[model samples]
Target: MLPFRFIHAADLHLDSPFAGMSGLTDRVRKHLQQSTFIALDRMVQLAVREKVDFVVISGDVYDSSNTSLRAQLRFMEALEMLDREHIPVFIIHGNHDPLDSPRLAVTLPPLVHVFGPVPESVTVVRRRDGQEVSVITGMSYLTSKVKENISLRYNKKAGASELFHIGLLHANVDGNQEHETYAPCSKKDLNTAGYHYWALGHIHSRRTLQESPYIVYPGNIQGRNIRETGPKGCYLVDVDETGAVAMDFRELDTVRWFDMEVSIGDCRHPEDLRLNVERLLTDISESYTTGFSMVRIRITGRGSIHRELEDGFILEDLLIDLRRKVDNQAGTVGFAGCVWVESFCLSSGAEIQLETLLQEDSFIGELLRLAETELAGDIGSDSVIGHALRPLMDQPEIRLLLTGSTREEQREWLRRAMELTALLLLDDQEAGGASA
Candidate 1:
């Protein structure tokens, strides 16, 4: 039997809105819309090129229940491309797009097979060489949340003749702090399931659980925002006749994610920051295919140039100019355009002073202690306060005051505002003395 090779991917989040974005140019926003679809098309193309035995999409085919009809149709069309190549596609719906009412009604490609909500079994796919290959057994989430552990549903053992046994699941194994604990299970739970490979989903970052059984999360095909940065893509698994699995990560995202931290510690002027940004972008452009890549530049560090970086309009203009240059030079070769700057924040070295306050006996220090006590007592309420005061705390003028203000003024207005704001918002009066 020919050994089985398959492509595993999840969390497509198709047509999801870029909710936390601002300052994106019209062109960039347009490109973001096509990103998921582009990545899906790329996945199908990769599958066709590789001539894999089958493709398994663990879960999350769409972004939400309110996904657009256009997105649904486009997705099916991409699947049809795989169908044309005679490649069978297996999919399971996750919490985001459960197999129920309200989702876009559409027909899947003939070659596509979707697992139902309940756990079920599928026979091992064999090769023409007469060897029994892998058996893929899986289940989808019926509702938005499956509170109970679902690993028990996949407890069946694989047949002896099968070279590999795979379990496809949409779950948050253990308790991932960054994600909801849906379908929680332990590594031991999956190991006991007796599967050679466990393809998992829900968490957006790529991860490898246990190599012996090969449990993994391939991450999302395309990143939707700054939080989901880095190279987003799928995993290619090559299984040998002895059930030895070799895996490699393949970049399927047409739009690459970049979260670059540009330090301005030595920058003497705003132009210096501008030039530094240009240098960084130029360096990135050199290494990547321009139009197809996206970059989020964050300006960091304490420097004299921090004050000048305060003008959002001017900084944005500089970024736009840089993007224009990059786009003009390399837009056609599938480079979408120039870099898209997400956000810029400035900090003054006030944190050191704040740290000292935590151990002091001064009035400000005592107030800071009290705030911390309150914060510990009820974190959720204090979080709301922090969110409300974040604008004032983040203001460039306020950050500059921490250093530039005279001793008398610092002891009066500056220190008082800091302490009061920290107590009321951050639940830590010590933050007023914190370095920006």
Candidate 2:
């Protein structure tokens, strides 16, 4: 067996319409939209630099079947670079971009090959030296919904004297519950397929189902939301002359998504908390000077400023100020990319004692007791929460906003409402006592 190296990438998701972002500057939004294309370019650049024999994308080359012309043109442009270097590119469409869907009349380069619906094998041959000993077997989805176990259909090509064999698939192996069970299969199916390596896709998180034959998912090229956080990229697999394999994971994301929880438990003032958040943002911006950061900041722990933050307008002001600071820093010489706060969630609790309030013979105590009874289901459907929230749930416009549907979830909502009501009652009592 001769030594060979190839790049394995999947879920490119080009021309993805990034949602949940509003009130962003034109520059920032433009950068967010171009992120996927940038990631693909980076992968192509890496392949050229490493001088890999070939590149295989398991599935999901585009976000949808109606992929934009810009995405198609950019994809072709990237592959053209690989073709110029004599590097072969193999691709298979996933559920997102099946063959049955309507697509633009876009053509690929001479060295590029897209696998059809039926299982087929293509041997990778080097143009300079005629070596076709490495065979790759793969198939694409004909339609968007593939409930069949496609991996079971793949088998090693017969009568092929190939030195190395690879299986390329975009499927949910072992019914990974996180994603839709399209083209589902199992580890046993792949392990017994007689392929030296399996390159997989569909799941957005990287994982290795088995190491013996190396069944791996390179994840997505770039994350589109906060749920898909951290570094996103592909794999570089190198097969040694002795058939021993070494795989290297590479980061190709141009815009990285991050989720951060900042604790203000030790801060005595709002100024202190502001400084802490600013400092953290500065560190992240300086660290990833080449890429943009979309961060979701969650404030946690008890703090004196918790009451102030509950005012709603204060949080809006804080977000505005933080974004202004980020924009200002972008003007600095070293800032190649800037950080944008996707959302600011306040989970900080108040510092008041709640046990004493529940014992009082006043409005706060009455409300708290009612909340406890309803939460325990002592009042049943006629409970205060049930009556008050029933109308809101009945309204079609507001129904979508209330996502919590379970009993425990209802209890949590009631509990939070009671806490806020108690705070107001306490303030009112203090004011009455001062006048009397």
Candidate 3:
């Protein structure tokens, strides 16, 4: 039996910038760029700590189609650490890093083996106590887009003398909606391949399809954005001679991604909003091991403060204050900053006197009718009256003015419409107040 273990990891989108993201501090940007190397370093450390026999990187080692020489060198240097520890490394070219690229010219460590695009496997012979163990495998990408099922290519069984059979593939594996449908295949396709373990990649989230044959995705070593939030890392697998497998998830990410939603429904003033934000940050910072963290806070829900929060600079200031609080509480947790506020709704209980306005056969009634009709068609449409009148109506401040008991309730609907209008016009300010 081969008395050794292996680490499987993939999708290291190194040095990829969050281009469309806004409201980020300069420190956050720098940390993101440096996180790639940090993750790589952690992987190497894990391999050395466990004294694993080999490490397999499924694909997407670099973020660019044309990788820089500097990045290539740094990557090789990190791998050299593993080579120095007398451990071998196996690499497969993913969709991002397809074979036949001449940009990578750095001399790799002798212990490292990089598989080409063709589906071929090299046997690794390990000797322990005068006994030899042979591991057979096949891997490759063939083309940028391997539309036809590639799992069928590995149907042939391994030799009887082979101690372990493994297949390293960069495939979509039965059409995952969350990922690009690259090399698609069914579970039956993999089961019939006769491989004891299939190290799969392409998807950014870690998943274990089956434990019997051990089909797994180590996920991306690090999360790149808000969409890819949660604990991101690699997998450590220990397979015995009898084909019994044991797997454990090991976190290797230096930077973490978190998405937080703070509802301002009860926030009547800017200070209330600030207090809510501070409380949320405090909770998040306490939950994480790393004092330094990056957060994307989404201000949501209907509230009176929605109009004040629409101001770009004012919202930015709120984020700054939240960051300051987190920094003060836990000096190590770095706030990457906040995300764009999706929408702030004003649910104040106040109604527009449409009956009074229409009693005089005024334009306000006609405008209200048009808005109601458009809203009926599609309440989300930009042409809704609330959206149309935002620019003309000006009420920057929020006030508690009520007359009729039910009048307040009626005005709330008008406020909501005004809120929607403000969003449509991109006013980033409050609309006119409703009169009971």
All candidates: TM-score = 0.79, 0.87, 0.75
Can you write out model 1's per-residue Cα lDDT over 73-113, one digit (the tens) per residue? Answer: 88888888888887778888888888773755567777788
Give the best candidate by lDDT.
2
Give the whole-model CA lDDT for all candidates, comma-separated. 0.75, 0.84, 0.68
Model 1: residues with Cα > 4 Å off, grouped in runs: 103-107, 127-131, 157-161, 310-317, 323-337, 348-436
User: What ranges in model 2 sit over 4 Å off?
Assistant: 126-128, 328-337, 353-388, 403-415, 421-436
lDDT of 1 at 326: 50
Give the TM-score comparing model 3 with the true structure, all chains together.
0.75
lDDT of 2: 0.84
Give the higher-TM-score candidate: 2 or 3: 2
Model 3, CA-based lDDT: 0.68
Q: Give the alpha carbon lDDT tens digit for every residue of 1-436 in model 3.
A: 6655788888877666656765545555666677777888889999989877778888878775677666677788888999998778888877776675456556789988888656766666442232344354556564466677777877444464456777888888878988888878988899987777888889998899997677898899888776687788899888776767888999877667677777877877878977876677567656655524566776767666666665556667766665555444433534333222212232332223444543545445555556555535532326554364455345434222222224335445554664454344333322332221
Rank candidates by lDDT, best first.
2, 1, 3
